[model samples]
Target chain A: MSKKKITIAITGLNNTDNPGPGVPFIRAIRESDRFDATVIGLAYENLEPGIYMNGITDKTYLIPYPSSGSEQLLARIEQIHRKNPIDVLIPNFDAELFTFIKNESWLRERGIKTFLPEMESFMERSKDNLSSFGKKYDFKVPKSLPLTGAHQVDQLFEELDFPVFVKGKFYDAYKAWDKHEVNTLFHKISAKWGLPVMVQEFVEGTEVNVIALGDGKGNTIGAVPMRKTYITDKGKAWGGITIDDEKMLSLTYDIIRKTKWRGGMELEMIRTRDNEYYIIEINPRLPAWLYLAVAAGQNLPEAMVRLALDEKLEPFHAFKSGKMFIRYSYDLIGDISLFESITVKGEL
Target chain B: MRIKRSVAVSENGFVFDSSTGDSFNLNGIGREIVELMKNGLEQSDITQKIIERYEVEPAIFEQNLMDFQSMLRQFNLLEE
Candidate 1:
């Protein structure tokens, strides 16, 4: 049979030391034998390395940041669709998922299909709302308080102990050891990611992550649990290996069943010395290390496209445990003209 | 007395439980015990081997072997 052709539009191409999901998501799809896909890279910055990487994107287009408002973001997407209509649109950033979720129907009207969680489901997994979400869902999320002002830092140690995490609203988390550091991170995070930074009580344990896919019907389509073998100073996983984690997988299934999650999600959890699992944060979309799941025999990006196209899929029950992924940095030199075109023409 | 089927001990005393993705390094004595365990040696038989090789008293080596066995069980590296 001839492979079905697909054109997928994806954002989050920032492949720096802190990577994004776009490059790996595209790599997974490109490796698929069932579909011949032409990838359309949607980048927010001209210098995102994936925009110029070979065998990654067929055509690259710079899109307006979603912080500008959904209408403006949609207008830019509409322009891209006029040039090359998107079959399935995958937005891969927590910061941008809000705009995409709000405009789901509008994108569908233009024949661009997307599989994303409802706004309610998305909000339920956010870092600031996690403690309440855990209480409602019967999960063990860490105790956290949202701070809109620096004055709230004084109340932090009163409620929770020190050696806690001072986290930005959308990204970045620093482990603070004292009030001085907490106050410093509060201002730093507030300056960058806006107000209401979260201070979460530290849970001391081995950190484990699970990448999962849900079909929006209380069904877990795929899940793979991994443990980072090496971590960078920024807390990103530099090397990780897949593990047999029935408890973590079970928790993921329960979260999906409860949320009726519609797309790729990642669970950041800590397995305590006593072997209890505490969810630290839940990402609403696939993580920067999503390609690891693909290597474990659950091709979530391919399955997501199929689900977005309304195909039936069975839940994945098994994956290859002990598989490892070690990430490294190498410079992919490109001509200045390539940078000029992406900056000037906004397409490469 | 029996190592889990998924556990592997390398020549350099490196051990890994493939099923759980947990890895550890063992000292020379620990590696020897694990090597004997992997070879299907019973606890009493392994005790004899350790006594001959390390020239330790039988009573003390037996207690240590039992403690090592307990650790193997705790780490899920021993079969039930």
Candidate 2:
């Protein structure tokens, strides 16, 4: 089969203890039988590992972090577009998704396409608004309270109870058994992710996840359910295996059909002994372990690219149920010249 | 009522559940019982088949088979 050539720019290259989806997404795109990809790695820092990984990126450009401002981020992309002309741009970080989603028109004007959910869909599923999202959409979500300062801890236990979940607005979750632990976790999460630490009622159950993609027209492009075989301290899945879960898939389809979501997403849920599923979080992008989905025979990145190109597609129906993925770290040897290139020129 | 259709049972003791991506190893007797279950044999018939071949009493074999089946359920290898 003859494959079309496409140039794609992707962010989220900080593959450390906690990984980013960029490298794995790039790897998945590289395997697309439908498209040959020219990967342009977008980095926020000089030493992002994906920038130096051989053949991972055809070109690497250092971009300003989203915190610096969205206008600056767009300006940098405009510059990168002039040089490389991205056909599709996939922003992988949770922090950066708003910028890309807000500027969807600017990208389209420049001939860069992105299949992202509308701003309304994006905002409604945010952590602060998730409880209402569940109440409106009819899914089970644990009651959540947002904290701006440590003083709010005084009333936390009275509202909820001990052994609640301490979660960052963007990332990180830890189980706090008592008041002291909640305070410690609150300070830790707020210091890094900023104020508005979230305290969630802990659901006792086995954790299951569904990685899914949805078309804008209320159809699921693809969905794969998995149970983690191994997990990290940071609550990342280091090893996982695909499962044949009809209920998980059904719930995902219902959510997509109701929301009419676009692009990639993950439905994180906990299944209790009674077999009831509680929606934990709905992340707006593909997970770092997405290669597991690709290996299981759903190339979501490829499908997203096709969707972004406005190509008609039939929704994916099946994936290998028993496929598994294990995440590991390795050392890639490189010289100072490559590091100097990115540090000095902002491009490698 | 029967072993899961997606289960992969080997001639030896290996058992793999494709639905959950979990695998287990069975003892010789456990392997025979699983093979019988896969073949759609009833518990009484399975006990008869085992007792006819082995020296164990029917009641004893049935008790052990129940325990073995419980283990299968624990590992999520059996159909609910």
Candidate 3:
């Protein structure tokens, strides 16, 4: 009997004290009877925290985060393949995906399957494109413009509006400064992070997230909508409530269709008093509570894994639309000072 | 720690909280523990059953069982 073989590689294992979903993902994958899995990281810091104790994977490799370009990253990944020969590659970090997308064709040539969407579609769905896509989809997006420098931003607020948001085009952060000190930091951040800086009209409303999984062919397998009840100082949603809403699902699907998106995508949205969900930004990868979606009866990772293996797609029952999921900050477990200082501002 | 009066467990791993009207799906071990709690088993009885059926070390299992019981108590899933 031919042994069913599948090699799973999880890249971007940051060994930092920062929390990650990779450890749990590794555990979940190892528990599955369907695949043989190995977890790999670009650095010791990138390795999921506490992975040394889990003993969950068939193997683990340490590869540093690629710095030069797509060519360098491709060569490094290819070197790993020469040793272990992965059949499927799952990039586990935002930065890693940016580099990996450029090498997608190279990896695909080796018969490795990935869940990445098209590069053009990816750029069209990013934070910089949020406002434009919102207009196209007939959704409310804050009035904003891309900031190339502080002078451009100064001109922006001078003509447009006040109390704006200055964020990175990618998941990286733009150095934020006071209104008086804006220009210097804007230049510093733009030069460091590399982006069309995001300057948007800050919308005051409920911050919500809608996470879903779709086959590249356009079928949305499952979705979970949530509101962050608590966020860590580091900007990670420490605690959130899973909310089920048909509107959230439809709005998410609308964006997904517009972008020709595939695989897992997390849409950040804000709901105004009039009950309209304004498009904030679309994260083109899995959300933090992806496991909660699994706990809520829509196992997206398992579904994606099945799809990658070319197994017949099973009928996925939609989760209870109004269900709520609450995830507490993992930092609360280890950081005493932060725990004592933490405050709960609203009903969870 | 105790199972709240509102928590209900079925023989097939289904759980319902009468207080919240919410239902949950528990794993086999979770089902067994919930059933044992319903049957009025003491901590020792539950531990004995778990130790005999699973490959976990007795000491570690006992510690984890106590911790799990404490957590369930905090969640109001048990009756004291």
Candidate 4:
């Protein structure tokens, strides 16, 4: 007997210097023997390497940017569904997750299933609300102040020290060492991503990350913690090693239990010299480095697919510790005609 | 402009600079331009080749080629 073939639509396929998680997500699915799948790559740019990479996607389609609003995105998804019904959609970008989560019901009505965090869960865990989240969840987060204007930058110095982190709501973080740098970044970030730029205290510690899945019922499906051994200038993990840290695992379980989170999440933290874990960010989707978790034995992406299909699954018991992952760049060879086809026709 | 003699470029667009111990991936156009540079092709020759092969305007191809050359310089792949 053969396993059923599942059609999964995925986004964030930009496998560049700063990669998206789509390629790794598809890799996990391909490695799984439980279910065969036809991977549909939803890309934003014509140059996304995943679209051209062989054995990664069966079909690729261009989608509107999230800035184009949820209505346009839904329309594009609907068009794709008309051609091939999407069994499940696993959106991997932080900026786009809100749009997908907002239209979750509409997608389900169209027979496109998605397992995502509840709206409230997604909202409260954002970087803007991290301080309050830490307060409510009884965890230590770095002191952060949300600045909506230039005037707020002046007051930031009184409350926080120099060398604070200036962060955009969706992306970009720069360490500003003086008031001039703070105000400069404030305007830069505001110009790009709009107001309410975050000012966070620079916590001195080693950075660590955990990728985990929750069952939406306060039960953790699986969790794997890793420490970056080498990071690129863009702050992306180029090499990392999985470690067996009881405290980090416990903290992951506690957060999931508190939020009753559904689907995949990545927790970025900083462990101080004293061994205190200060969670810096909570990404509601799988990280680009999530293949490390699958390689270590969790296979969370496969579990997520099953969970989205409403299949009952037992929590992952154990994963191999001390596993290391070194990311390498692979040049996907293709002709200029393929690029022109996608650029002109919007699909390949 | 000349490509550094120590820069190892594979047919698959994997560029490894032994002097700096850095590796990079290039798109098809980028690889073609770099290969042309290695072969000591003039700027006009490279521009002509790209315009004939790609479905892009000659002016746009020139602008893109300049940008790609700037990136190569930024990555220190060009000889001083």
Candidate 5:
């Protein structure tokens, strides 16, 4: 019998210059002999020297954004399917995940399977979901409020103590501050990105992350806990050490079971001086350093892909529980601007 | 495969028995092998079944099974 043909369509390859989370996923596919795939970029311009261009994908397609509605996006993807007929569509970026989930049924009807969870599930597991999930698990989430306007920003500072965080609903978080700096920073953010934003009570302590892959059926296939030793300008953990913490792992499992989460997801956590773990927020996408987990011996992306393909996924191999991975950003050569910014941000 | 519960499982898969806490996020194949081990299947039997069920060569299957078993053993999820 001939080998079954499986085509995968991945999005957002042209958005960033560096190897984002998509690189590792694509690498896993390239390493695996299971399927054939064509990656489609959804950005306005082409990104060369990218992981895909650097031999990660079998083929690459640039799909232009529609000037009109989502139907255009669907039509474009459908057109690609007519030619290649993708068996699975795995979106790596947040917006791509959102778009795929929004048009999930339509794509499924067209015979393209996706690994997205329910849209409502995304909302329920969002950063806002952090506090609620924390409350359910008897943990405290930092006091936070969704920003309404620049005027309300003052009230936020007044309501809370100093060192509040001004964050976007999307990715930015854990920004440190006192009252005066936050008050000024609030206006700067509002002027750039409109409200409502997230103003969170700053939890000072060591930073940690919890990652897990689920079948969306209340089965957590695997989980990992790590600490943040370094962070990037884009708010990604640059270097980190994995640690073994019983309480944090329990909390992570509790949240996953409660949410019935699927695919790959990450949790941001803070350890107070008293060694208490406080729930910060949940990022529903894969981390850029996810490959570290795979390198540590738990290939989460491959597991998710196999599970999505209905292949029997083996229970995760037990690895070194506290294995650490430190991400080193390459090509910072002579970039004094980056150095200055790191100094100002104090994240170096 | 054998799945001995540690003091670490939280009704969810949050495992923390460092004695067996972290390991390969097993692919479907690895998961099956572990389950078989947990079920008291010997490595030889598991390899035999893997060769019969999957298209991988017997030698490769044997090596992978041994490596996977060693990994599990190293993590304290299995006894010698």
Candidate 6:
């Protein structure tokens, strides 16, 4: 039987030193034999490598940044939809997701479907709100203080210990061992990402990441836990290996069940030396290393696409253990004219 | 200024220094300047070429180019 053709638009195409999940998500979709997809790459920057990647995206269009407001973003999507109607739009950036979630009904009116968590779920899972989320769910989460100003950094030591993690609201984390370092990072992060910086307790242990899909009905569609073997200076996983940890898997299922989460999510957890699991952060979308889940036979992106299309699927019960992924950089040679085209026309 | 003899650059703006075993990615303008440097072009000549083709001003491009040169040097991709 011939596969049905579908047009799916995805954002967060910035695959750089600090990578985005778009390319990996595209790879998973391409690997699936279930659908013949027209993958549309939505980029905010012209230099995003995925935009220029040959044969990965059928077409590429530049989208307005999230800070430009949802109205502008909706207009851009509508423009793209007029030319090529999109069936599903998977926003892969955490920063842009709030806009997408807020405009879900508007997007649905235009026939653009999305699989995302409810607004409350998305808000509760934020780094600043994780402490309350953990308390409500009866799970272990690091102690975190949300700071709206630089002056709050001075008071952090009173409640939190030294060597706490100073994190931006959307991205970036720096370990501060002293007041000076905390002050510097507080200002630095606040300057770039805006107010409400998070000061999280430093949990020392092995960092384990889990990629999971929820069915929006307290069911975990799939889950894969991985251990970062080598991390870049930017705190990105350079090399990682999947581990067989039932506790980690159970914790993932528990979170999904409790939240009744929908769509793709990545839970960053640390397994302490005392054998306790502390969920550090919850990424609302598929992570940059999502292809690793596909490699491990979970194929979460494919499952997510199926769910988005309203196709019923049984929960994924098994995945291969001991799988590994080592990310490497590749130069995709292109013409100077291509760069000029994307820079000038905002599409390629 | 010159790109180190051991550095390999690809058209896609990927730079690798075999001696240091370090790999780096360059933006489009960075790649253009590096290629021009490889051809033994002076900083002013490369800056002139960039300003002619791109929509950037000479002063801004020169300042950015100097910063980029500093980055190149820090990464050991450049030599005096």
User: Which candidate has the top score in TM-score?
Assistant: 2
Off by over 4 Å in 3: A1-5, A15-20, A41-53, A172-178, A181-188, A320-348, B1-80
**Error in Å for residue A248 of model 5:** 2.6
How well does candidate 2 score on lDDT at residue A242? 95
TM-score of the second chain, each candidate in turn, equals: 0.94, 0.93, 0.78, 0.94, 0.68, 0.94
Lowest-lDDT window of 10 residues in candidate 6 chain A? A148-157
Comparing 1 and 4 on DockQ, the stronger one: 1
Query: CA lDDT of A177 in candidate 6?
Result: 95
On the 0 to 100 scale, the lDDT of residue A139 in model 4 is: 95
Top candidate on lDDT is: 1
Question: Residue by residue across A158-222, what tens digits does model 5's lDDT show?
Answer: 67776777776665554655656666666666555455567888888767887778788777787
lDDT of 2 at A227: 89
Reference contacts reproduced by model 4? 0.00
Candidate 1 lDDT by residue in tens digits, A1-348: 678998999998889888899999999999998889999999999999999899999999999888887788899999999999899999998999998898899999999999998899998889889999999999998899998988888877789997999999889999999989999999999999998899999999888999999999999999999998988988999999998878999999999999899999999999886779999999999889889989999999999999999999788888988889999998999999999999999999
All candidates: TM-score: 0.94, 0.96, 0.70, 0.80, 0.70, 0.81
What TM-score does chain B of candidate 3 reach?
Answer: 0.78
What are the per-residue Cα lDDT tens digits for candidate 4 across A64-147?
Answer: 998988788899999999998899999999888898999999999999999899999999999899999999999999999999
- Regions more than 4 Å wrong, model 5: A1-5, A12-19, A33-45, A48-52, A64-68, A174-180, A187-194, A322-348, B1-80
Candidate 3 chain A, poorest ten consecutive residues by summed lDDT? A339-348
Candidate 3's DockQ is: 0.02
Q: Provide the DockQ value for model 1.
A: 0.59
Which portions of model 1 show Cα errors greater than 4 Å?
B1-6, B10-13, B27-29, B35-42, B52-56, B66-80
Chain A in model 4: its TM-score?
0.98
Model 1: what TM-score?
Answer: 0.94
lDDT string, candidate 3, A97-187, tens digits: 7676777777889877777766776777677787777777677787767887566755776655555666665654332435653555466
Give the lDDT ranking, best first.
Answer: 1, 2, 4, 6, 5, 3
| Candidate 6 Cα errors over 4 Å, as ranges | B1-80
Residue A100 miss distance in model 4 (angstroms): 0.8
Quote the lDDT for B72 in model 3.
74
**Interface Cα RMSD, each model:** 1.7, 1.4, 7.8, 13.2, 5.3, 13.8
> Candidate 4, DockQ to 2 decimals?
0.01
Better of 4 and 5 by TM-score: 4
